[model samples]
Target: MVDADQTFVIVGGGLAGAKAAETLRAEGFSGRVILICDERDHPYERPPLSKGYLLGKEQRESVFVHEPAWYAQNDIELHLGQTVVAIDRAAKTVHYGDDGTHVRYDKLLLATGAEPRRLDIPGTDLAGVHHLRRLAHAERLKNVLTHLGRDNGHLVVAGAGWIGLEVAAAAREYGAEVTVVEPSPTPLHGVLGPELGQLFAELHREHGVRFHFGARLTEIVGQDGMVLAARTDDGEEHPCHDVLAAIGAAPRVALAESAGLELADRALGGGIVVDEHLRTSDPDIHAAGDVAAFPHELFGTRMRVEHWANALNGGPAAARSMLGRDVVYDRVPYFFSDQYDLGMEYSGWAPPGSYDQVVIRGDAGKREFIAFWVKEGRVLAGMNVNVWDVTDPIQRLIRTRAQVDTEALADPHVPLADLLP
Candidate 1:
């Protein structure tokens, strides 16, 4: 058990930071824990911001990870609206703001997370152009959607990743004419393979979503401080009322780098380097969640996975490691995205061409299917669209590394449960 007087400072109060603090208390740490958040509001779950929250299906309070009373009852000190500008590694302390208030820590955890990558195109600063990253961003987007009077205006979402698609789906549900622009030949080409991405492209196209594949956005045209249109490199100008950039995110590691902690080149994954224990170069300081770039057991390479599951699992793993527990933080990374009428569940690791054989289960025509990514008779990864129950058994098969009969596995009538050990 940790002494009540001991100080533990957690930087960045997102899902990762909040979960880490909760796990520490649950693990018998009764120390003085301080959660420092640059935002005024407490920690909240971000996944819904693109789907339910933006669609007004969920209340703002409902999105918060925990209520204010829970923190008070747990004796967790939440320092909201406070920024930790620098880390004083020599004194084992962290400095905040221009006034320079400093606090010493016995152990520190950095879960600074990531920020939305902005478009470098001209007219990006226009009033109608937006980038969703924080609660404030979502709130502003909500206001914009409300102002546009749902279903009447056009919303141009740049990028084809999960973030872009989810927002496009939300805007569509609000009755807005939604168009998704991507430089890639297929949407989600980075996450899902080209075959699967093409399938998704067909899915969206059927639902009235215009796809601008291989089209590069050259400029964001605006008038009177409001975005008016997006001009492509091909010189095709598409009129839009509001523009949202969902290109992806970058790690917020300024504090870590300024503290003299070693950093990997941004060209190489661009995340804070950490060992299996999630410890940085400094023994007292650690990193976790999206900002953490650690070694992957399956690929035998260093990479950073920015997903909701990483934030949920990595934070506690780092906290447990900090508490002197022997733990090797390795789990088959899993994530999901809700876009339009599709609910996608994915598991395991997939490097480019990681799977030599693709065994598809269920019927894609029915709009409920599972695609199994296999290599050397081993399940490398799988994606289930609008079929959550099927992935449960596939996940089990992936976890156990069971040899599946390719013929039997592909049989839709056989059911995924029969393929599991």
Candidate 2:
């Protein structure tokens, strides 16, 4: 257990950071707990930013991880709108902005989340061009969407990932003409493979969302400081009133990099390297959330996951490790997404392009199916799309790593629980 007098500092006020602070308090650490956030708002969740909140189905207050009163009640100090400029590892302190405010910590947790990758092309600074990562960004996008609905505007989304697709669905729902441009042959091809990707493509197409597959964004054109059109490398220009560059996000590793922490391999996207216990090279400092690349004993590889579940669970694991508890942080990685009429739940780890075969149960055409990625008859990963109440069984199959006949696995008549040993 940590000493009662040593302060524990948490950087980044997103879900992970907030959970870490909660864990520290729950673990009976009576010392000071300081959570530094760059945003003025209290710590909040991000998934709602692109879904319910953006669609007007949820209110602003629902997005926060905790009500403001909870922090004060828990005796957790919150330093909002503050940027940590540098980490003085030797002095065990973090320097804030130019004003010279600093905080000392006996144990520090870095949950610095990722930021959306900005488009480098021309006209990206136009008024109608946006990237959604923070609540402020979503608020701006929602306002633009509201006006676009009245004007019968067109929106061009430059990417086909989860954010891009979900935004496309929401935009379509808002009565905007929507077009999605993707460099890949199919949307979500890298993670869900082409078959499932095609299902998503079909789903969007049926909803009047146009697509430009195998097309790369060349430039965004603007008129009077507002987006008017988007040009692709395929020589096609899509006229639009708004553009969302949902290409991807890069981990915010500036603090870890500046502190001279060991980074993972460049091939693995270069996040702060951590051991099984989530401790970085410097034992006093630990990394979690999107910025941590830790070894996965199940997959026999080091990976960094940017999904919500990873951050949700990893925070407490890192806190346990900080308090000198025996923890491995080996839980099977899980993530879920909601797009259009489909709800998906995926579990276990199967790096892109590693699975040998994909076996499907139920009808893919009916949009209700569970797809499992197997390698040499051993289940590696599984995803249930539009299917409910099977995540536990799917994860159990992955955890056991049992060999099974593909025919029995694909037969919906056979119970998933019956296959488990």
Candidate 3:
């Protein structure tokens, strides 16, 4: 157990960091807790930045993980807008930017999160081009959407991932013509499989959003530093006033790399490698959130998840592990997204190329369905689209790994709980 006098330092001021600080206090760690955040804003929920906050459905204050006063009240020191330049593991000190401020820590948690991957196509630096990762980025895009609402502007989206699709839905809601270009045959095919991904494609099509599947963005044509069009490798030009690239995200592993922490396999996308308990190569340090590539107890494989739920749960789990408490970060992975009128919640993990068959309940055409990914008669993962109050059952089904009858699973009349052992 950590001594009450030793200081604990947390890096990154995102949801994971804030949650870790909260966990430390709640776990009765009376030692000093310092949260270092690169962003000036207090820790906040990022999901709304793309959906609610950008669309003006939610206020900025509502996005914060904790009110600013809560940090002071909790006695957690905030080092906002300061970058930790390096970690001297031998000296047990975290060096800040060139000004030479350093903080000593008995235990350190890295929750640096991930950054949106940048597109390398020509004109990516244009004024009307943007990437959604932070609240500031969302604010800027919201302004662009507002302007597009006034002028009936066109938007060219370079990806059809979650961010891309959600932003497309928001742009269409704002009366902008949206064209999403994806090299994949269907949106979210990499994660949800072609069938379910195609459902999303059809949903967007119903909302009047155009799509260019099996297409690559060759260039972003611009004039006066403002995006004017997106040209595809297939020799097609899509006229537009704004462009959003939501290709994916890469974990912020530079700090851990510089500190010489072991990295996960390159095939796993190379994050800070950790054990099931979230302990890094250095026992005194731990990693959580998107930056942590740890062995998943459920999947029995090394994996790193970039969703909000993982960070929300993993933060506290890592804190407990840091406190030398016997802990295992074994919660089943879960995530949800909202696009247009469709809301979806997915539970369990089914990595790419895994899960042989998809069994569906309800009507896909009606946009209300629960789809399960089954492998060898065992449920690996399940997603409920526009279906309410079924997440717990779906998650239980996944957790149980029970052999399910495909016919019963496909029947809406068959209750989900009946399939559980």
Candidate lDDT scores, in order, read 0.85, 0.90, 0.91
lDDT of candidate 3 vs native?
0.91
Model 2: pairs clashing at backbone N, Cα or C within 3 Å: none
Task: Compute each candidate's TM-score over C-alphas.
Answer: 0.95, 0.98, 0.98
- The number of clashing residue pairs in each candidate reads 1, 0, 0
lDDT of 1 by residue, 1-421 (tens): 3577788899999999999999999999988888899999989988988888998989999888898888989989888999999898989998886689889999999999999988888988898898998989999988777766554888888998988888877776667787888999998897787888888888777777898988878898888998789988877888999999999999998889888887767986687889889999998888999899888776567878888899999989999988889978887788988877788889877755667887887888776888888877778788888876665676677877888888887787897787777
Weakest ten-residue segment in model 3 by summed lDDT: 294-303
Tens digit of per-residue lDDT, candidate 3, span 1-421: 5777899999999999999999999999999999999999999888998889998999989999999999999999998998999999999999985698999999999999999999888999999989999999999999999889789999999899999999999998999899999999999988898978989998999999999999989999989898889999999999999899999999898899999999887666778999889999999999999999988666778888889999899999999999989998877888999988899999988856898898989988888899999998888899998998998998888888788899999999999999999
lDDT of 1 at 99: 86
Query: 1 or 3: which has the higher TM-score?
Result: 3
The Cα error of candidate 1 at residue 130, in Å, is 0.5
Residue-by-residue lDDT tens digits, candidate 2, 1-421: 4787898889999998999999988988889999999999999999999999999999999999999999999999999999988899999998886698998989999999899988888888888888999999999989888877778999999999999999999888888889999999999877888877898999999988999999988899887898879999989999999999999888898889889999887666778899999999999999999889999878888888888898899999998888899989878889888887889999987756788988999999998999999899989999998999999999999988898888989999999988888
Best model number under lDDT: 3
